[model samples]
Target: MTFYDVTVPISNAMITWPSDPAVSITGTSLISRGDFCNLSELKIGSHCGTHIDAPSHFLENGRTIDQLALENLIGEATVFEFKNKENIDVSDIKQLRFDNVKRVLFKTVNSSYWKFSTFKKDFVYLTKDAAQYLVDKGIRLVGVDYLSVEKFESQLAETHHTLLRNDVIILEGLDLSNVERGRYELIALPLKIKDGDGSPARVVLKST
Candidate 1:
């Protein structure tokens, strides 16, 4: 079996969404300093690094991270690569057959931004129409190669609203640059933060 680690490494220098809390790690205990073991303090946003967004991330009355279905986190997924497209629309999604596809991960120019030293605000993202299209097709999970599924400057928060409102799980900040478009078995497990709106996840894929 060939396993692909699709999660990005999290570090202090890793780019995070603008306005979100910056990631920080500080050593609190060290064997070099006469401590018995090594320990570090970590501070990061719930949406930091590779993470999942629960319905509560956008809907007040929706389920939180812990409430998400485990079946949705592991499934057969299809990877769709989009090129030269600034925004993913419903037409793009319509071109694929979603039957038996529980999860869909999109690889776009956003993967290129990960190579940069700083965050790029122009990552390709989903338009509201595309989000709605997925929901209508009964997609249970959606993953993107950037910090957000919606465009950075989305005026109406339409894309997020459409997916979150329908209980679709959103996985973000994936590092899909090294992978090709194909069917795969996805394993994306988020921290079980009780009643929390979101949580960081460790995602991997095995070629099918």
Candidate 2:
């Protein structure tokens, strides 16, 4: 069996959402420095790196990250490759086969952006209609290669609201450059932060 670690590595210089807190990883006690043991400190946003967004990320009085169902975090998932240069519209989503699939991940051109340390504003994202399509198809979870599922600078945040309100788990900041289109067993576990709207996750895929 083969496995793929789709989670992005957290680093002090990693790209992040414009307004979110920047990642700050510092060595507090290092063996090289003659400390008792190697220890580090991390100061990052809850939504840093490859993370899962719960309903509380967008909806008021909604479930927090720790409240998300584990069934939705681990299961068989289908990966769809999208070559669209712009947003993922309904047409692109129409090509997907949603049968018997509880989770879905999109591998798009945005995956290429991971090579750069700077955030790209024009990365491909999902359209509101496409978000509704997934919800209508009974998708329990959705993953994207970039930092967000919605288009950059979106004032309404409809894509997030549409999915979150329907209890759809949003997995973002995945590194899917090496993954192919197929079915795999997804294992995405986020930090069990109490009252966290989102938390960084270590997402992995095992060949079925």
Candidate 3:
């Protein structure tokens, strides 16, 4: 079996979404410095790096990260390779047969932009129609290789609301550059923060 790590390495220098909290790692004690043990302090937004967004992200009374089911976090997932499309549309997703698809991950040009030092504002994102389409298709989980699943200037915030309202687990900041579109076993586990709207996750894929 081959295992592909889809999560990005979180670090203080890693590029994050604009206006989001910056990641900081400070070593309080180090064995190299003759200290008892190495202890580091980590500070960052819950939504940083490879993360899972719960319903509370967009809905005030929605479910929190800890409330998500483990069954939804681990399952058979399909990776869809999208190109040249500024916004993923309902028509685009309609062509694919989502039968037995528990989770879906989109690999787009947005994954390529991760190579740059700075964050790209115009990365490919899901449109409102696409979000509704996924929800309508009974998709339990949706993953994207960018900071957000929705476009930057989305006016309706429909993409988020539509998915979250339906309890669709949203995974973002995935590094899918080396991955190809196919069926894979997905293991995406986020931090069990109490009542957290979202939390960073370590996602991995394995061929069955």
Best by lDDT: 2
Off by over 4 Å in 3: none
- Point out where model 2 deviates above 4 Å: none
lDDT for model 2, please. Answer: 0.94
Better of 1 and 2 by lDDT: 2
Pick by TM-score: which candidate is best? 2
What is each predicted model's overall lDDT from 0 to 1?
A: 0.92, 0.94, 0.92
Q: Model 3 over residues 1-208: C-alpha lDDT tens digits?
A: 9999989889988889887999999999999999999999999999998899999988999999999999999989999999997878888898888988979999999888877889888888888888898988889999999999988867777889989999999999999999999999999999999999999999999998
lDDT of 2 by residue, 1-208 (tens): 9999998899988999999999999999999979999999999999888999999998889899989999999999999998856889888889878889889999999888988978899999999999999999999999999999999999999999999999999999999999999999999999999999999999999999
Worst 10 residues of 3 by lDDT: 150-159
* Predicted candidate 1 versus true structure: per-residue lDDT over 131-168, tens digit per residue: 99898888999999999998887788888899999999
Candidate 3: the clashing residue pairs are none
The global Cα lDDT (0 to 1) of model 1 is 0.92
Clashes of 1: 0
